[model samples]
Target: MPILEDLKEYVERATGLRRPGKRKVSDLARARKPHAVRFKDDGLVPNHPRWPLIIYRGAFEFDERHDPAAVIEDLFEANGWGDTWRDGIYDYVHYHSRIHEVLGIARGKGRVRFGGKKGRIFTLKAGDVAVLPAGTGHQCLSADDDFLVVGAYPPAGTYDECTTIEDRPRALMPIPKVPPPRKDPVYGTSGPLSKLWKKAK
Candidate 1:
């Protein structure tokens, strides 16, 4: 174990793998709250009461991949977020009732309305990432023809499109019970998602 640790340190040093300085909350991650990104409530779909929308701006940029989806897929997988897929946002408003979701905007730009029909709109570009907690409503307001996103969920969680009132009862029960992600999709265990999710009211 000691040899492995020494080797790892040496490799990191040689490869310019600078260690993260500390776990302090970054200003970017503190857009609305310590780790929350509140959206305008559309009055149709109630956002996650405990976990708000999380936006990590420019999380994956300046990369040689030239493809946003590839970078996001790799990032999500590295942080234990699986079941990833590449696609564009839905035109109609919708929400997931069971599992949380992360969307990495890899290409183009678009305005997204979150928190149901009455939600607020935000223009998202490549390199921006939005982490939507379960039950939060979202939809693509408008976008360029090339708009694309890479989305994934934490391990053991699966997504379900829920818009009907009947879905609420079943949705709420699973959200709090949905196990906390082992690590934040961008910052790992020390990131905002780790600090916010599973937090007591």
Candidate 2:
């Protein structure tokens, strides 16, 4: 079923056609301070050394009139992030070696561990968004029955998942080389991501 869903998503993205409905992609976002944290390499995870993981709490204020998942997709697409997918976080620790990622909480709530075994655990509810730089490890600690996450990536890099110590050698090369997204998935050029990431570089 998951494979079928992924194929459908790929087709949708390839065709540039989203699920049809009256989408409210207007002003549903809230201006919030982005909380950023840097994580070190745990030998296995090879987390990004320079870029910090950014969290935007209550980034969007959603109501019954809006589909939270669709709202996230719209916002991400508008900001030049593509290849959107909807699913829950993985149970085991994993990182994307070649590209940065943004995860938006669209339904229920979840607790995720960022970085590796030494990373911090965050409780994310609906409307929260987390932007992870390349090679940042993430694992799902817990989630509600209805928990759902909307994830997307920038057009700069290819997507590859790394989970084992053996993958570290191959992952390290591209971790730091991955280019930062020009716009925040939730906010455009004026968002904190622009200045924060720029200053870090």
Candidate 3:
């Protein structure tokens, strides 16, 4: 009960701030692929796939009067990770290409949209487990009540530099068009994206 209370407290605190008017994604969209921080031999590439970003799920509870931010920080530390606060909105349109994430919902309900394509959404509820593949664009939608989610990332420190986007409300940027993957005997499977395709294939 304490865990749940604590989680509830956090959500309340996070939502206490002024609720900005909802901004829907524009009908006319341009191409803009999601990007995550990556370390490469030739600097960081914004549009590469990094897969298998694993995370350990943990138990949590909610507290109406508890500090959600502090509780989240504590949870991350206990699990050997650090917490960084960006603009405080439960729902967001962002993607981490280098890491896969596991989300454990402790309380309440919410929805997550993966990929740049609209109309595709994943919903979450108490005791539900969702695995988010890397390089996929996602955003949380409709946090009706307080909800707690534990996310796990792979490749260590991949989340150290998470980019938070602000000023765009309820609108998704278009996915950028990129060159197709190479197919030939000369260009054998290599690099992060190639590895992900091989594993998924």
Top candidate, metric lDDT? 2
In terms of lDDT, the poorest run of 10 residues in model 3 is 20-29
Whole-model Cα lDDT of every candidate shown, in order: 0.69, 0.86, 0.38
Ranking by lDDT: 2, 1, 3
**Model 3 segments more than 4 A misplaced:** 1-90, 155-157, 160-198
Clashes of each: 1, 0, 19
Worst 10 residues of 2 by lDDT: 17-26
- What digit string (tens of lDDT, one per residue) describes model 2 on residues 85-160? 8889999999999999999998889999999999999999999999999999999999998888889999999999
Output candidate 1 Cα RMSD. Answer: 9.4
Residue 152 deviation, candidate 2, in Å? 0.3
In the range 1-201, model 3's lDDT, one tens digit per residue, is 446655544664477432111121111112222122222111122222433222222223435543433334343333333332322123555655434444556456677654433425656565443444444455687764566554543334244222344312211121122222332111113323334334532
Would you estimate the TM-scores of all the predictions?
0.76, 0.89, 0.41
- Candidate 1 lDDT over 23-86, as tens digits, reads 3212213233233566544445767777778777767643442234555665676778888766
Error of 3 at 108 (Å): 1.0
Off by over 4 Å in 1: 1-35, 39-43
Instruction: Compute the lDDT of residue 154 as modeled in candidate 1.
Output: 89
Model 2 regions more than 4 Å off: 1-26
